[model samples]
Target chain A: QKEVEQDPGPLSVPEGAIVSLNCTYSNSAFQYFMWYRQYSRKGPELLMYTYSSGNKEDGRFTAQVDKSSKYISLFIRDSQPSDSATYLCAMGVDSNYQLIWGAGTKLIIKP
Target chain B: DAGVTQSPTHLIKTRGQQVTLRCSPKSGHDTVSWYQQALGQGPQFIFQYYEEEERQRGNFPDRFSGHQFPNYSSELNVNALLLGDSALYLCASSLVGADEQFFGPGTRLTVL
Candidate 1:
């Protein structure tokens, strides 16, 4: 199995809808979890990062990580049409090793 | 300040040819890393350079190589490229020992 697994979603939702994206991992050694958003033809931008198990909130986005279950999620509130993009989950033990990445979930917020 | 910059926004080459991609890190970032993003997939780490040396590498083969100049700008060179090498090449920069990374717009390479 892949170290990190995410549902490759082309999920479509209306503007102002709440959206949830998730990923599950098989490695227990992953200490850092991150969420990145990538627009078409653009680089992946860091959206949220969490050290371990817990929740971190930034404006309309909330990130949750569960070490015990090896699961992580990103929740977007009051989603906007501009929020359309591919969301990728990344994790790593440290900077010494390369980060393992998920397949990414594509989200489309319709107007 | 500019976040991160990559050159030759797109490239097309044939198998058995060589290609070189360039990257300029975010202002004030000293470490540079390279990744390959296949179509419909996440980016895969190739290697990272710090202080002009390769600090770490991923599972990529020896045909993939890189260099970092004293100024922190870096280059990724793929020798004798294969058709499977077609993908988006991404460059990321970060502070030494920092977990957060900033990425460039990436160069799309097509190997026919």
Candidate 2:
């Protein structure tokens, strides 16, 4: 199995809907989790970052990590059309080095 | 402050041709890493450079190599590239102790 697994969801949600994206990993050594948003033909933009486990919130985005289960999630509240992009989950044993990434989930917030 | 920047925003090359992509890290950052993102896939780590040395590498072949300069800027060179080498090449920078990396706009390489 891949070290990190994420559903490649082309998830479509109506405006103002709640969107939840998730990833599961097999490597327990991974301690740092991150979320990145990428638009078409652009680089992946870092969104939320968390070390160990717990929840970190930034405006409409919330990232939660469960190290015990090796699962992580990013939640988008009140999604908007501008939020349409591919969301990627990344993890590293050390926050300063190489990261393992999961295939991103494409989200479309319809107007 | 200026963010990481990459050159030759887009490139097209024939199979068996070599390509060199450049990147300048963000100010005050000393480490540079490279990743390849194919269409419909997540970015895959190629290698990372620090202190003008190769610190770590992923499962990529020897055909994929990189360098880090004294200024912390970096270059990725692909020798005798194959069509499969075509992808969006991304450069990311971070300080040794900084966990989150800042990415450049990336160089899109197309091997025909």
Candidate 3:
């Protein structure tokens, strides 16, 4: 099984709808979790960063990590067309900064 | 302040050819990491450099290598490339021991 698993979704939603993207990992050592947004042909842009097993909120985005369940989630409120992009979840252990990434879920916010 | 920057926005090469991609880290950052993102996939970590030395590496083969200069800029060199080498090569920079990393625009490599 892969270390990290995420649905490669072209999840379509209306503008102003709430969107939820999630990832699951089999590694128990992950202590740092992050969510990144990538526009087509562009590099991944960090959207949220959180330490183990908790929720962190910024502006209209919220990131939650559940170490016990080996799951992480990013919730977007009031999504917009500009929010249409690929959402990736990445995690790292305390030993080194190397990150294991999810396959990413593509989100489309229609107007 | 400028974020991370990479050179040669796009490149095309034949199989077995060598390619070199460059990156300049953000100001005051001392560590640089490289990743490869294939179509429809997340970025895969290749390796990371700090203090002009290789600090860590992922599962990539030896044909993939990198170097970091004293100025904190870095270069990724792929030798004996195969068609699978074609992907978006990304450069990310961060302060040593920091959890957050800033990424460059990336070099899109196509091996035909």
lDDT for each candidate structure: 0.95, 0.94, 0.94
TM-score for candidate 2: 0.98
Question: What are the candidates' individual DockQ scores?
Answer: 0.74, 0.86, 0.66
Q: What are the per-residue Cα lDDT tens digits for candidate 2 across A56-99?
A: 99999999999988899999999999999999999999887889
Best by DockQ, which number? 2
Q: Residue A22: error of model 2 in Å?
A: 0.3
Task: Tell me how candidate 3 scores on lDDT.
Answer: 0.94
Once model 3 is optimally superposed onto the true structure by TM-score, how far is the C-alpha of residue B1 displaced, in angstroms? 1.3
Can you write out model 1's per-residue Cα lDDT over B2-106, one digit (the tens) per residue?
Answer: 999999999999999999999999999999999999999999999999999999999999999999999999999999999999999999999998889999999
Candidate 2's displacement at residue B81, Å, is 0.7
| Candidate 1: residue A63 lDDT (0-100) | 98
Clashes of 1: 0
Candidate 1 Cα outliers beyond 4 Å, as residue runs: A95-97
Model 1 lDDT per residue over A6-43, tens place: 99979999999999999999988899999999999999
DockQ of structure 2 = 0.86
True contacts kept of each: 0.71, 0.78, 0.57
Model 1 reaches an interface RMSD of: 1.4
